[model samples]
Target chain A: MHDARYGWSSVHRCPSRHSDGERPRPARPGGGLTVPTIETRGLTKSFGDVDAVLDLDLTIEAGEVFGFLGPNGAGKSTTINLLLDYIRPTSGSVEVFGMDAQRHPAKIRERVGVLPEGYGFDDPLTGREYLDWAIGTKDADDDPAALLDLVSLTDDAGRMAADYSKGMQQRLAFAMALVDDPDLLILDEPSTGLDPNGVRTMRENVADVAADGTTVFFSSHHLAEVEAVCDRVGVMNEGELVAVDSIDGLRDTVGGHAAIELECATPPTELGVEALDGVVDVAVEDHTLTVTCVDPGRKIDVVTHVAERADVVDILSTTVSLETLFNELTEGGREGGGETTAEVAQ
Target chain B: MSIDSVLSKDLTSVRRSGALWGVAVCLTMLATMVAYVNIGRGAPPLREAQDAYGLLAGLVGVLVPIVAIVASYMSITGERASGGIKFLLAFPNTRRDVFAGKLLSRLAVVGVIVLFMFVAATAITVAKYGVLPVGVAVGVFAVSLVYAWAFVALSVAFSSATASRSQAIAAAVGSYFLLVILNLTFRFSQVVRLVYDTILGLGENPHLYAAADYVSPYIAYQKAANLVYPAAMERQVFRLPEEARETLPVYLTDEFSLVVFAAWLVVPLALGYLRFQRSDLQ
Candidate 1:
């Protein structure tokens, strides 16, 4: 019911109406606003001579699923560790919820839930007991039984934490993070060892929580998971965030906008739609017209005109996958220029 | 928000499934219950019960190090190994709170075990003699506990700095033995005495033994323990040679050495807490 209300409200609030009568809704006070949940400016960390994270500047918005997409040794974990105050940055500062994180890590952590990668809980306690102990320090309205049920660990809840499988342990960790119903959830490689269905459930759970206006900051090498769950993603390569934007915005930057696929019963002659605005390239494969457009909607009119001449059987659009987009953006190229690619100093 | 909550949680958690409490209790029972050769020959008298004070000191001497080492090693390493340190550190407690809470809990473990054993020892002494020397027994127990607490802090310092349980344990034990052996050798060996006399200029120095007292906390504790014994009172009555007098005051008569040993506890603990606050947990 709440979903419908939000859905309709979002649809009615047109982009132009964002100015005139509305004062941007007074920044939503504390909810649904783009306030920085975590902000790092000129953040640098070094272990001896090796720089793990170098001059990283990032802003993770409140209530947004912010994905830190990076490869191994790309400093995703290091950045998370810095934010958690497990390690002090060699330079610069980290702020969480508008407070200095290093100075008040404990207070910052109280409102944040973190599932650190490869974290192993004590073996003596059962799954339920471990979660209970983990959440004991926080204020919560959860019973271990309900939490176990949510994570689908009702049966295994009785078993010792050591006896849990890798996936089960991961699930239990997720349950532990959810115990406090935290405002900020920081997950480092959250879907590490899960099966396909488990991954789906994990993705759904993350999305569901983020949908309810909890800021989620997660790091993952799996671009598909990031694409599915994150509203905005920052790609980290060699300890620097190279790109930060919505998935669609990244795709457009990397793969040069969304393409409209037109399968016509009769192919148009002379590629007339190529001369149309926003149509970058046009290729006719048998009866299908594959139109690569800088603006998909602009080409939509041209495609419709062409379809009036040719009997159109199918009309489809293609957006670049997160993987292809990530590679192209990080690799650095000049095929299409729309948005400026952001680069962080090392 | 409260330090007691943190300390209470630590104590309860450590007591539940961990082996520290059980080991401490077992060692204390064995030390107090078993008859030692050092306190024997005469039976069923006030003097005999006073003789048991030295035996009780010996019991504490053997048991305190073991408990100190076990509890200290378990304090930080156990939490880190279980990944509970992250959970604990993430709460609304500062590094000072965490360090102090763990230190107090470990000390409390030793205190509880030693107190139980002291009560048992007093009961045994009462059964053998007509009455218990409640004052001496309780004072000795309290003094020994303070001394044990010094080592407990040292062990925790090592535990916080080291990466693994084995490493922490090994470091604690190695340091413990090194101090004891070095102090013992410095006291007995003529070559060492000659070296100290030549290099550190202690040949005719009156304060040579007093300066040497810095090597081990055990010496200070042992001196205090002897003072609580009735034999020590007898020693105080007899006339002694000049060297004996100087050595006796340094080891057995000075109250200031215990204060210095007590400082060792606080300094290492502060260093450990600082390191823990900044050190990466990876």
Candidate 2:
């Protein structure tokens, strides 16, 4: 609080817009030896009368890749804006690297790199030219050619940015953000619009950057990509974070649930024989039955019994994917009686 | 972080056109020779000829604002349209730096052009007639550049606030004609009356008339190009008309116009910079 390396004078004191400012920043997991790279307490933002992000709390540690999971318009971009200080928040407080973001935005930005949701760049300049202009401000002279190689855009460095494909533009955007060699990289859907190979390259580059002690904060709708790349994941829905944990932590938090899928000759009247002791919910459509259960260990026994009772052609049981876990955590409407698709689908 | 950075960055970016300078210099020289030919056609002495030529070149004043508008119309808008403002503003420098840097560079360019015309006009007048008074010629040259600086600043400021290049150019040119013609006659009647009264006071001796006219910086810049040596400035040559002399103390005393011209540089520039700084690029 009394450090000169980062200080907040009286001019920097932000008014507490809501109860959000009072929410404690989350400490990192395990022994918490590492300092947090990004933290927020009850951070909220509203545009006109609509709330974009509401009472959100998140913490990401140094050198850890964290994925912010949310569907479009579910406040993913809004939260990024708040974190980056692109827009002022209506309530709550955001802290990046333990420094109040509003007070020290320039300093925070000096250490933080961002790839916005859109692949927005100034046209009329070649990719090489634009990178030179961007990297000029930072202290180091970054090699534009090397950056192009990292993002797999080395072959197209001389082309005007306006002519680049959406995936190629996304690659350029990532390269631009990383040009400064920032300590933290915020990538909002970095792999958006990319082919499978592009996505693989993106993941590899993100991993490479994180390996160099840069904390990678990325948001994506592809839950599997998030699970594969992120050491921790935070699930967001309806302007709020529903859960924040490691992939396995989220898997454990949503643990004991398995999806039992079966292909049948006809719609069953009742899945009595298939109703395993641990099954929580069941869905029957066409000739398929999807059973949600607390313990998948009993799924094979239940399927065998169902096969004995009905003309079941094929049956399968597998651990729930990250997509399923995300649906389970974020499903259901805000409070009360509106059942969510996750509830129905589960 | 430093003014030098802003200056160097701007200088580095702008594409200089050698052809523009070549064309501008040739045109100035041609205009000077034409004015000399008129003098050769049995026109009055160096004094009368200077006034006539000065009046013609003072017309450039009407277009000076327009030139400013055209030169600067795309300074900010071009950068904004190309998504360059964000990259530029991301630096620690303020908008003030951008405004100042751009204005200075424009003024420097205009200064060179004004100097070329002034030199050509003086050379032609000396060639047509005998040597003119050195004081009057030097004063005219200095004052013309100042006026050019003022117009350039005015145009650049308008350019910075405008959304498009065409709009900025239109506003600058339109405002120039309005201020020089309609606004002086209609909106500011008092100033026009003073100007008209001053012009009529000029007698057959066009030299005195030209000298009194130089009291108006607009007329003074023209007089400099025409090589019109005002009698008031050269007391030994002729006595200034009593009325022209009376207005002399008021009109020739340019503290007020100088301040107005200075404001042209300061106010619009400040406002333009503020607008650029706060505007959202995306």
Candidate 3:
């Protein structure tokens, strides 16, 4: 399990593992079989009359980069806190590495690295000192200078962490989370205070770690970031897991199609494009033929059929982006009308 | 190992706090000046040195609790308020480790200050009296250290039980007023007398007033310090009437005051840990 050779390829052998819900365990580099990195069953947490997280059942496989997407106050941080056993669940159970999270918190945390949300460094210790203490507590021999270099904070290692800017503190926290080569890296809002460059670097670092067989579970509301790196993303709204699927899977589930606009020399009149497979709609206006397809791959077929009928001049195509799908999912749930959202999830 | 890491880190962070240093400097000066003034008045007899030690003990009994409360009242609640406890617990450390480490580190700080005060006082005594009473000095140091620990434990207990810094500060300050200030000014005993004689109509009961006075930690410290240096009780903060002192019960003895100190040290810590362990830390 500690060997680096059990990379992403081994886990990708079963791409449909998450969908099926009960697949065989993956074999690690040392011939050891390991369970999912995280699993929650009927997990619920409530504060008085409000339910922060309600009946959440999530499973993140090893070597998979799972993105937890939700708006502010949508229970993303509460879910992460439950997984870390920072708070008790009102009902239900959470297991990490096949062990009960509440009962074996220390043992689970020994293998997990976390960048908790809203964390602060009020101590007078420098950035380097904070990293050193983290490494020592984990009983791992991580070089503080190397970790600082990874976050591009080596120059500021001597400065007090409490005095650092918000962005710099976020970077330092990310570096600290990278210590001990953790089996599971849980980042709650890791991109909260990052600039464009820092965000790019963070995305790359996440990709790099997941490639090396580290199960990366990160929570963020940034759709583009989730679309960039996650194998599967879970959408949460109002303490409920509204949807969980790959970006393409979500697009397909929402029945969002691609519209290919063909700017022909003249509009096609009777191309018989309506009869083509996967074509949802076809319209013509002012020398442009717009063909909408449920499956984007049918764009080639639509264009071929249109070329036979008219002189094609240009082609412009647009697929449904994750942003549209995310808005559709979360907005439906947020409007207090969860019926439409539940149908889409199903 | 986790506890050790937390202990060392807290020690490093708390030692740099200006409040602790300010209290330390004041305590050292108080100890030195008390010794210098009393002994420099000429060696009339051996009783002079004992009187100086008694006065120093009285002053320390008052100051040590202040230092301890200041050093520890924010040990847990401050971190919770600033969100620093999240960072500390993000590693593999358990809640037990965090509680134990914070208690021990703050106690260690107060212990060092109490030791320094005694050492400076001992230095002055040797310089003026031409001889050192090592047994008395060590006994006073031991009793003062325990006294300091009791207050530190109580303050840390408050810090652990409270979720906010303001709440912890209120509890610590309230305890100091009730335990140290009221007891020192004899107001606590007066209230007890009023409740027993006036409110309850039980007539004058000096024994109950004496017991009420000793409930305060500083008064218990004086009673315990009397065990080491008998003359220390001659200048008691609240002197019982002659009739009451003649037939003192077991609970009023100097040794029983050690039991009061022990209760102060243990009960609050246990209760605080119970509350902290069950809290959500949201």
Q: Of the candidates shown, which would achieve the greatest TM-score relative to the real structure?
A: 3
Summarize candidate 2's per-residue lDDT along A28-129 as a digit string, tens digits. Answer: 454436457888888888777888889888877666678899777778877886776655688898988888876776677667777876434544567876
Better of 1 and 3 by DockQ: 3
Please state the CAPRI-style docking class of candidate 1: acceptable
Compose the digit string of candidate 3's lDDT tens values, residues A6-78: 3443344334453443323345444334577799999999999899999999988786778899888899999
Ranking of candidates on DockQ, top first: 3, 1, 2
User: Which stretches in model 3 have alpha-carbon errors above 4 Å?
Assistant: A1-33, A257-319, A336-346, B39-45, B231-239
What docking tier does model 3 reach? medium
Displacement of the residue A305 alpha carbon in candidate 1, Å: 31
Candidate 3 residue-wise lDDT, B86-137, digit = tens: 8778888888889999999999999999988988988888777767776677
Q: Which model is ahead, 2 or 3, in terms of lDDT?
A: 3
Ranking by lDDT: 3, 1, 2
Predicted complex 1: DockQ: 0.28
lDDT score of residue B268 within candidate 1: 85
Local accuracy of candidate 1 as per-residue lDDT tens digits, A62-119: 6567889887888999999888887789999999987897898778877888888757
**Whole-model Cα lDDT of every candidate shown, in order:** 0.71, 0.63, 0.83
Worst 10 residues of 3 chain B by lDDT: B230-239
What lDDT does candidate 2 reach at residue B250? 38
Candidate maximizing DockQ:
3
